[model samples]
Target: MRTAVTAMKIPPSLLSWRSDSWRSDGRTDSFSNEYFKRRNQLKRLLFACLVRWFMTAVLVMGTYLVLWRYSRKAAMISNKKKEFNTLIIALSIALGLNIASSLKHLDLANFEPLQRPKADYILQSENFSCLFQLGYVTRRHWVRVYVLFWVLVNVASQIAVASLGLTYNINSADTIAVTTPGVVAIPDMSNIQTGKVLSSNSQAISALRYTANNYGLVALAYGFGDIDEMPKAGSLFNSDGDLMYCDLNSCYYVFYEATPDNLDYYQSVATNRSISTQATCQSWRVLKGGDGTERTITIDNANKTQLTIPALNGGSQTTFMVDPDRGSGPTWGHVLAFEASATDPWFYNCNVTIGPVTNVQNPLQDVGVNVTSLAASAIALQGYGASTIGVSFNSTRHFQFQSYPAESYYGGPQGGNNTGMGQLMASFAVGVVAITAQVNTNVNATGLLPLKGIELDITSWTYVHIILILTVGLQLLLAVIAAVIASKVTIRDHSCVGLAAALQPLLWKLDNSGSSRTTCEKRIFERLGDGVKVSYIKGRSGLYYIKADE
Candidate 1:
């Protein structure tokens, strides 16, 4: 038992406190070493924390400021007011959450290779499992790509909503009015024919010859012409004579008197040369009797009556005759005659007389009035005196007519009570109140126009929005994980083993004994078995070294 105790006892040289010569070795106090290591770790942790805070502040506040300034600048340049407050708030929240999560993932200890597995080892381990392969590479790039895609989709949706314009229906009334003027009168012809005389007798003789030949009395008058003869007097005859003649149809007696005054008086009223001589003879008051013939007579009195004689040439003659009962009647009676031929019969004479002249004023009148339209089912016009006019506006054409509203004259669609008088009265009332003389109306008119309203079709984008939201969340998560991975120090293969395994060789005396070595190896194998394949291989130095298989 004494021998076993001695073998297990620690040597004095190994323990510095138990050795008098410990000062000769250049080693610090164990407690002080531990204190310094702890202090260094604390400093490192604080530095890491400060860096994270700085990065978070820059990312959050800097991004917000940049985005705010950019939005304002864009609004000014485009001349449009855009609201980004909500978007800014949402972005800030997202960034804050990201920062918080990133900070949460940060571990100061992960920065030390002695404290954790290196990046290569982690990557190797991740290769062994498909689940961890994503974490092997940074996911920040993919998250940024996805965020861009989401932003594009959101912008497209907004544009689509803006493109949907306006729509609606309209209805109304329109009116029009028109006016025009009335009839005209005629002028006189007697004063124009009153100044010529010697030429009158010649005209009378020529007229006598024409009348005698026209009546077929020339042959008979010349054949029996020798009752009495007198001295030469006028151009009507070579000498004064009285001639009597008879024809199968009638008998005529001719006498000529060619005084200048008498010729002048005859010329004033004669229509032609044939009547001039006969007119002069009658005015002398020498001949009297019915003569059973018709002749034109002229009277100068203002109270004279007018008469019309039918002519052989399909025309009539107008002449004035004095009122026989008037006190200022002419002293002479004029008679001129002509018998109708058997081939042309004459009926009772037609008497035409001039009536007293009247004075008149023109009233408003509408002629060729037209109303047209496609929208109106009916159009109507009404005027004073209960006159109404209507048009069936069914045809896209003009409705035209002459209408006298003041005279109670109406045209167009008739019979309906609302159409004629009633409509006219309504129009008149409107005009009176409106201080206008014309009124127009439309019936059953319908109009159309545009209105403001909108509807969004988001059914197809429902899943897309959801996907975008989830993608944003995923991006944040990926960013945090990437931050953590970046902050971590690269780990070595040896660091994967726990402290117990590392201190095993130091705490136990395994190198001198086969059993102890076997025990240490077995312990190592047991602890690392789940993560890696452990094997022993002989090296060139003729010693066995442990190896980890991937």
Candidate 2:
């Protein structure tokens, strides 16, 4: 018997099926292939697919093996985001192509018949409800578990690959050996000229300086690169005794710590505790004649200049030897003495030191060394072409009182008349840190070496390889299984319209008088079984039709 089917009027959405996708080896009734002959053809197709599966496996495995070996060191990349993204994109494209090739297979054994239920799992792999269709067929056809396995593995590998960067250590960043100018003071600093700290147009340093315009004139010069608008480094009178330096986003800190040392001289006065809190303690006082009862006026033996604060009741005694010549020639160098009365516990004599800090755990805490005299240089510039920045501090320039004024010790620097000794010390420190930060900003450094970085954490970062393995591995394996039993695998557009059109051959055979809706079509076919022998033929109007025999 011979049956012919013309094109059906299908909606645009449902007509998307590629009806001609399958190759019809049998012609019309005159050339119809017997059932056993077609079955043999399916068996040969199965063998060919098995060969393809093995080739796919070898291709995927060998490609990844070469990749894994070549990336043993994986030389650190400076632009991590760019390079890593490139790698992921390349893999995604390659995987996509490989997956596309493996998708349209009727993975089957040589003798198995293509059944309605089996085709459901095979052909519907590209459907929107593919997961659901796969689930339904999985009861009798468990090969879909392999598909689900690959899906789950891909999800897991993707998550691991996304977070892989966080696991990397400093080795992931590219590095180069470099010999740079070390920290110096005076000639040591001058010899290693850091790039000039700022452009001539910038008043950032002068503005943040504790000294007025005249005093900071020496430090204001066009030396650092010519960036016009730059971030200001330290605040004016930043008396926290800590400075922050930044380069290339990495940061460092300098903290000034005051620790009490062995007393050079201590004289007990008959003045009461109230004497320690006198107005002279408000600002660093140019000490005049003391109370004259127990206080004696005397010059420092070394420089003859002195800053004195006679303790008032309930306050503290603070005195520092002043260097008159503004030159480094005194026996004592630069030291401050604060002697709280026997009853007062608030203030004590201490020496100053600067500590190196990579992290800032606490801003209030003071942290590193005894300051006999500070004349060292801090390098702000990084790499070649960096301008040499130098800071030279000599004279005792006055500073805005930051803390501990006798008038209101609890208040922050209120009613202070004398200059803070540490304020002067802060001037030196501020210049060091600010200059460094400024020069670093111009050069775009993270602070020290620009290339400082970490290596890949192999334990976690290797997830990229696993992504390839699971994506390619199970895909090939399952593609082979999904290809099982069916004679032909459709490679054209897998649209519902195309599929419905191709069913024209079965149109006249199945029962659809009352329950002929699309939903009942599957049951109708299950009841009838896949026994029809059909062929696709090109018609004269550039269209194709279906022919079936009974």
Candidate with top lDDT is 2
Tens digit per residue, CA lDDT, model 1, 1-550: 2243332433322111121111112223211011112333334434444555555545445443544354233112111212333444455555555444443333212121211123223323322232133233424455335334434443443332222111111111101001011111101111111112123323232232222112221122233232233212111232223333222211222222111221222110000011000011111111211121343322222433233332222112111121112211111211111212222221111111111111211111111011101000011211111111243332212221112222222222222222232222222211111111011111111111111111222233344334334434443444444444432321111132322332333323333333443555456344433344333233332322233443
Global lDDT of model 1: 0.25
Listing every candidate in turn, what is its Cα RMSD in Å to the true structure after a full C-alpha superposition? Answer: 38.9, 19.2
TM-scores for the candidates? 0.18, 0.33
lDDT of each: 0.25, 0.34
After superposition, the stretches of candidate 2 with alpha carbons farther than 4 Å from their true spots are: 1-88, 103-106, 109-321, 326-332, 339-469, 476-550
**lDDT (tens digit, per residue) of candidate 2 on 1-550:** 5477795675543112222233344544321111223344444544555665665556556555434443454343345545554664465455444444445343232112234554444445544256456555545444566556545544553453344334333343232211122211111111112234333323232222222212212222321111222222211113232233322212233322111123232111110000000011222222333322233333323443543333232233333222212422211122333322233222212122333433433321211111112211111111121211231342233211122333321222221223343333333333443343223222111111212223343455366456546655665555445544343322222346656645555564554333345466567765456664444444432234444443
True-structure lDDT of candidate 2: 0.34
Error of 1 at 463 (Å): 23
Could you tally the backbone clashes for each prediction? 8, 51
Cα error, residue 369 of model 1, in Å, equals 35
- The window of 10 residues in a row where model 1 has the poorest summed lDDT is 268-277
Question: How accurate locally is residue 101 in candidate 1, as Cα lDDT from 0 to 100?
Answer: 43
